[model samples]
Each structure stands twice: as C-alpha cells, then as structure tokens.
Target: MIEIKNLCHSLGGKLILNDINLTLPEGSIMGLVGINGAGKTTLLRLISGVYSADEGEIFCDGLPIGDEKARERLFFLPDDPYFTGHTTGKALFELYRVFYPDIDRKVFLEYMSEFKLDEKKPIRNFSKGMRRQLYIALALSVKPKYLLLDEAFDGLDPLARLSFKRAINQAAEEYGTTVIISSHSLRELEDFCDSYALIDKMTIASSGDIAERVNRYCKFQLAFFEDFSEQIFFGLPVISLEKTGRFARIVLEGKEDDMKKALEKLSPAIVEQMPMDFEEMFIREVEGRGYKV
Candidate 1:
C-alpha cells in the first residue's frame, strides 16, 4: 500500500501542491488525471523520491519513501525517460539489472520479442512508440511492488495500446503490482483502471471507484412538443444543460431513478437516459469548478 499525508511541495518559491493526503491499496490500478500544469507529475515525483517534499510524509508499506528498501520496491517511468545516443535496449537491461538484481532476463527478452523491438539496436534509432515499448518491457522485468507511470499511453498505436494494457493487467494479477498511471487518455484509463484520482486546483478534487463515481451523474436527452426554457431543470441538481429549440440534453446529479422520475414529470414528448462515460464526468467536474469546458 502507498500512503501520503499532509504533502506539500513548492518550486521557485511557488506552491505547487498543498495539504494533500491520499491512500492507495495494494494490487490496484489507479488513474491519475488533471489538466496541464496541475502538479500531477510533481506529485508522482514526490512519491518516487525524485523530489523531496517541503512538508509531510510518504510511505510505501509502512516504510518512508526515502528509505532505500522502499525505493527498491518502486519503479517510476517518467513521460520522457532518458536514453543516450549509444544506449541499446540490451544495454539498458544490463544497467537496470545492476540496480534491480532480480530483474528477469527471460521476461525482458520475451516482451521485447512480443513488442517486435531489437534489443541490440541503439535506442536512439527507435521511434517514440518503439522506445516506449522497450521501456515497458524493462518495467515488466523489474517487477517492482509499485509502478508509477506518467503519460503511459502517449505514443502507442492501437495494437501497442492493447499489448500495454494486457501487460499491465498481467503484472497486477500475477505479481500483485500496484500501479499509478497518469494520462490524458481518460477513455483508455476508464476501460482498465478500477479507480481514479482527479487532481485539480493544486489538490485532489476527487478520487474513488470509477463505476461509483460515474454513477453519481445521470444524462438524458429530451425532446418537447413545444418550445421550453432551460429553467425547467433549474432545481433538479443539474450539472450541465444544453437546449436547442425543443430539444435538450441535460445531466443531473442524484439517484438515477429519482432524476429520471423528476424529468419524466416535466412531460417531454421524448425522454431518453443516455450512458455517461468517464470523459463526460470529468468535463462536468471541471466545469462545476468554474472552468469553461
């Protein structure tokens, strides 16, 4: 498990994150999401010990993250991982083996083959997606207890995305590896992550099971026989509403059954409840905070 308490950090005399507290259980995959410059990377760095916190403590399985033993159990994959011009994928594996002595050579080779990467070739010759595949192979070989990934799906084709997701799921199921993945790809995250944390305004705006969080908001498309004003949903826990002539699309926050009944009372010619996906939930969340999404 990972626990962070009273976490605060600053850079160049400007506060980036403050009073942040989070707990992640073992063997679960979590999606870390936020807009640009929301300190998502900073928080991940703090957890991985790349940057020391100005205040508060971070623990991995009861040991401080600064502890070498704790650090050994954690692997952090930054958005832009570093590789020199002459660094070959095979050479990278050897280097990682020095630090992670338990790194599985066979597993690494297997994944490399699956990804169709030439480990003997210089990493600089590989495209962005290929490099990412190489590093993911390395990560799987390391088999750390906790894996931190930033922009995990940035440069992958659809096939590679499938392979990546498959590998991550396999790691979690077989090795009990806990993962925190930061990404702008909410749809993909929604498909795999069991839970999510939303970082906004310098802190965690929301975090919970993906299904439960999405269930809180209900969406509906309604068509009326005659013109009607938006005020019809003024007191119905409306999160967002769009009206065009006699057609309207609305999202309400309440029990689904209750919201549906309330809307039914409005007597529309047609009322259809639409499924709300993660992307829609995120848009509504930020929009509720006065963002013009």
Candidate 2:
C-alpha cells in the first residue's frame, strides 16, 4: 500500500504540491489525471523520493518513502528517462540487477526478443518508442511492489500500446502489484484503470471508482413524436441541455430508472441512453470545471 499524508512541497518559492493525502491499497491500479503543470510530475517525483516533501511524509507498505527499504520496493519510470550513450539494453539490465536485486534476467531477455529490441546496440541509437519499450520491459523485469509510471504511453504506436496494456493487466492480476500511472491520455487510461484521481489547482479535485463517477452523470437523447414544448422538461435535475428544431439532447444527474419513468408521461418518440466513453467523461468533467479536458 502507498500512504501519503499531509504531503506538501515547494520549489524556489512557489508551492508545487499542497497538503495532499492519498492512499492506494495493495493490488489496485490507479490512474492520475491532470492538466500540464498541475503538479503531476512533481507529485510523482516527491513520491519516488527524488525530492523530499517540505511537510508531512509518504510511506509505502508502512516503509518511509525514499528510505532504503522503500526504494527497494519501488520502480519509478519518468516520462523522459535518461540513458547513457554507451549503455546497451543488456547493459541496462545488468545495471538494474545490481540495484534491484530481484531483476529477472530471463524475462528481460525474453522481452528484448519479443520487442525486437537490439540488446547489443547502444541505447542512445534507439528510437524514442524503442527506449520506452526498453524501460517498460526493464521495469517489469524488476517486479517491484509499487510501480510509478509517468506518461507511459506517450510515444508508442497502437500495437505497442496494446502490448503495454496487456503486460500491465497481467502484472496487476498475477502478482498483486500496486501501480500508479500518470497520463494525459484519458482514453487510454480508461481501458485498464479501475479508478482515477483528478488533480487540479494544486489539489485532488475528484477521485473515485471510474464507473461510479461516470454513472453519476446521466446523458440522454430525446426525440418527440410531435412538437412538444421543450421547456416543459426545463428545470429538471440536469447539468446541461441542448435543443435542435424537434429533438432535445440533455444530461441529467440521477438514476436512469427514475428518469425513464419520469419521462414516460411525455410520450416522446425516442428516449435512449447516450453512449459515453472515457474521453467523453473526461471532457465533460474538465469542461464542468471551466477547463478544457
């Protein structure tokens, strides 16, 4: 488990992270969402012990964050990973072996072969996509209990992303590893994350089960048999409404059953559920907060 209590941090003179409190239980996968410069990267740094917190403390399985024991159980991969020019993929594995102690040489070799990554060649010569693949492969090989990934999918192609998701899901399912992944790609995060946290204005704006949060927002597409006064349904429990010549599209907040029965009296042509994907959910959420998702 990861525990962050009253965590605060600053840089130069400005606050980077406020009194943040977050707890991630073991064997859970969490997606972290935030706009650019909204303390996403800095928060990850603080958690990984790259920077010390100005106030409060962070712990992993009751082990102090950044302590030697905590460091042994954590693997944090940044958006921009640094690799020396002369290091090969094999050399990287050897380096991790010395530090991680549990690095799996066989798994690393298998990944290098599976990804078609040349272990003999210097890592500096690899493309951005290849470098990302290398880090992901290496991180998995270490088999850490807590994994922190920042923008893990930034440079991958579709096939690579599919492979990455498959690997992540397998890790969560098999070994009970708790993963905290930060990304701007809500559409992608929605595919695998069971829950998410939205950080805004230097704080956690919202955090909860993805399904529960999405279900709170109800969307409907209404079609009328005849010209019914659209204003008749006005002032209902709704967050937004859209009107065309004959049909009205609306979003409400409540149970679909109660809503369906309530609209039965209208006798509309069609009242159906509007499909909402992860991207749509995030867009509406940020838009509701007066920001672009």
- lDDT values for all models: 0.95, 0.84
Q: Model 1, which residues run further than 4 Å from truth?
A: none
Which clashing pairs does model 2 show? none
Summarize candidate 2's per-residue lDDT along 66-133 as a digit string, tens digits.
68998898899999999888989888888898998779888787777877898889988988889999
The candidate 2 region of ten consecutive residues with least summed lDDT is 275-284
In candidate 1, where is summed lDDT lowest over 10 consecutive residues?
229-238
Model 1 lDDT at residue 68: 95
Residue 108, candidate 1: C-alpha displacement in angstroms: 0.6
TM-score of each: 0.99, 0.92
Clashing pairs in 1: none
Cα error, residue 276 of model 1, in Å, equals 0.6
